[model samples]
Target chain A: MTPSAEDAAAGLQYSRVLDAPPELVFDCFTQPGHLTHFWAPKGASAPTTEILVDLRPGGRFETLIVNDATGATYATRSVFLEVHAPDILAWHEEHTGMTVRVTFTALPGGRTLFSLHQSDIPDQVLRPENRAGFATTLDKLSNYLHHLADGAKQ
Target chain B: MESMLKNRPPGSLDAAFAALADPTRRAILTILADGDATVSDLAAPFAMSLPAVSKHLKVLEASGLISRTRNAQFRPCHLERAALDGVGDWIEDHRRVWDERLDKLDQHLAELQGGKEERDDS
Candidate 1:
């Protein structure tokens, strides 16, 4: 076991193993051309524009993602917190109030496994209907927890 | 209720983040998650005054993370789970986007490696 784990506190995580080595994967993340090619959402036809990457502590990364349907552009601006080449890249986005930490692990077959963890995501991304569903689910969970507490007391 | 929605902070997510930044406020939310509570009930657990808890409640209300009932007597504060849940959903959206982008990265890398192998053989 390579001790692959995502911090529960982060609240968001995704891990995938790539066929390339860690170094190569790191370059793909850092390079503007590579990011322009892959950073857009699946099925998104608009090429990513206004890419900026300053790979250092306190450095900034800015990108624009255009929605095909509405032709709306969304901007993501973040300051790098940690940048360990070929191993980790972490950043905190002020506008979104979220911190994203990505870790690159080296596998035996020259493959790389990286996990992306995001903490404190902002509410702007959620649609109203989805938010309503979450509220109902939360109420259910609250009731369940309350019952558990009562059982413990008994 | 519609007025309350209108009164919600302009940048809803920004307000939500600011409201949840404090540990005390987060604890308040956890308690309310159990069930709605009055200001005094929320205050009793903390070593703080009713006014402090009330202030925190106001912040939560403004963030649309909690709602207070109109009843003047209890004015029970209920958890607005949607705001918190919305944060989770936001993260999930980004995770999905990353998954797609990373998959593309994998394919790009395979192409690069294949090119290198062909060059070496030739």
Candidate 2:
């Protein structure tokens, strides 16, 4: 599924083309076996025991990541908002009030372009005025912070 | 396993989100990010009246995004670094998590497909 203009403005977006088929890439996200192999960040591990995926709308998709060095765990609980195999997977994270949408598109040479977009839904859904300038504001803030850091270094 | 990371207080985050919703308030933040500015200084760029600018400042101030100095007559608003950092950090942290996970997924896919090809040959 494509992100709307408002969603694009207020959301965090990331996309990367992987050297695999869309079906395989989608399975890596939905299947516990594939997810257990790479669900957590580097240095953190998501055990199959803790990785749960009920791949239907309104179903649960949860994971627990344990930091290898710190032994710290981060758990996420989300409900699937949309689940269309090999194409789209969207979920609403309960704790953060953020909805994450992931799309996988087939490329020319057996590759898949995986894109993820996350946005805070509650405020954006309630108020329309807040949507347009969010991403631009963030870009300005990020640049400003970088400038401050650069000045400090010099 | 114990959950190590605690979620940020939803109230403050909610306020920040709400405060950032308006284009005017966001423009105010952009102005303050470069340097602190008074209501008059902020309002000049937008052609907005002082009261309207003050209203946006109030929302920003309440959200802890900007603080106004009490000593000066104009009460210049200073951007609160912590609040801005909080919002940036939240997004960055999630982005980092997905980035790393996707990197691993790339490697896993190669291995999975390699094993399948080997099996087909055998």
DockQ for each candidate?
0.17, 0.16
Query: lDDT of all the models against the reference?
Result: 0.67, 0.70
TM-scores, in order shown?
0.56, 0.63
**Candidate 1 docking category?**
incorrect
| Chain B TM-score, all predictions listed | 0.68, 0.68
lDDT of 1 at A88: 95
> For each candidate, C-alpha RMSD in Å?
10.8, 10.3
Model 2 in CAPRI terms: which quality? incorrect
Candidate 1 segments exceeding 4 Å error: A1-8, A45-49, A123-154, B1-88, B115-122
Instruction: Give the B-chain TM-score of model 2.
Output: 0.68
Q: Candidate 1 at B21: error in angstroms? A: 18
> Model 1 TM-score?
0.56
Candidate 1: RMSD over Cα atoms?
A: 10.8
Write one digit per residue (lDDT tens) for candidate 2, span B1-122. Answer: 00111222332544565456556777788888789988889999999899988888887887678898989988999987666766565555666788788879877987988854422210
